[model samples]
Target: MKFDKDAWLLEAIRIKYIIPREDGTVWRRKWISADLKSMSREVHLIKQRTHKATQRVYFNLTFKGITKSVLVNRVIALAFLPNPLKLPQVNHIDGDKSHNYLKQPTPELVEKWGEYQLEWSTGRDNEKHAHANGLKTGRGSQNSNAKLTAPQVVEIRASAESPSAIAKQYGVARSTIVNILEGKTWIHV
Candidate 1:
């Protein structure tokens, strides 16, 4: 049988992260830096332990005790070896890939998979939306948009136009203008 070297390196790297301690202990990790560079599963290189050595690497996964290497090109792989077989895609529910629990899956594996992963801008979602939208990129959203910003009021009044016109130009909602003009949110002009 031949051994795959590249595969061995990858499994070794991931094992350092996912595999439980040899003492049968589990540890929690913050986040796994995504692998931006991945190659074809079949792209195996013959890594000689020495110029003429025969030892090589083969990437494989094992849920419990069953170990075998499978060639498939993917950023992530799942192995369902123990009882109660599962689909082969692991989910980091909390966006923490090191929390490899076959337990409660998250929305990343559910409803909002990629749509909610957009980067956050002002009025955009951030950490607050992390649970509902795993692997989020943007800052959390403000709870509501009922109030006007102080700069918004100044832009409305100190300008040579009506609040409605300025509101349209600024892309802010219209009611925000009323709040600014009424001094309910920011100091009115």
Candidate 2:
């Protein structure tokens, strides 16, 4: 549970059994053991011969006094190896804690849960939050809007020969008359 400053990971392996493969090679089944003497009780179970509960032989560590216990398999010891990273918890580097090896660190399994602290704290996805800041309100805006009422536009059209001429004669911008003539933006016809 706590691999503290004083604590160290001890490498002790125990062979469960061996199975002969089709290629005439024997595969050794081994596990890791504890470094601390306090875990001696569980360590004894590793070498002891016990009765079979099911089909497979279960060679497990019996942590009598110590609350924390680890695998007593050699290959598993090789899997995690001499030391591990300062992780929030014990993680299987290769998705399998049984495959703990020094060179093969569990980078994928160990995620930075606190990396996006803000996201978790706010309870909102980053994309959902509109991170926009618009420009400040207008400053010094005169009668910039060429908002001429329909009646006003009609009068201008009637007084002048052409839309452009009407715009010029009525002191309105030429584009405004052209817009009215072409029935663009704001004007229906």
In order, the Cα lDDT scores of the candidates are 0.39, 0.34
Give the least accurate 10-residue stretch of model 2, judged by summed lDDT. Answer: 114-123
Tell me the lDDT of model 1 at 156. 72
- What's model 2's TM-score? 0.21
Q: What is the total number of backbone clashes in candidate 1? A: 9
The C-alpha TM-scores of every prediction are 0.21, 0.21
- Model 1 residue runs over 4 Å out of place are 1-6, 9-91, 94-98, 105-140, 143-189
Estimate candidate 1's alpha-carbon lDDT, on a 0 to 1 scale: 0.39
**Highest lDDT, which number?**
1
Candidate 2 positional error at 2, Å: 57
Per-residue lDDT of candidate 1, residues 1-189 (tens digit): 776433553554464433333221232232333462332333222221211231221234442233555322112232222213423322333354333233334565446443221121222222334424434422212225434444555657677777778788878877766666676554212
Q: Report the lDDT of model 2 for residue 134.
A: 16
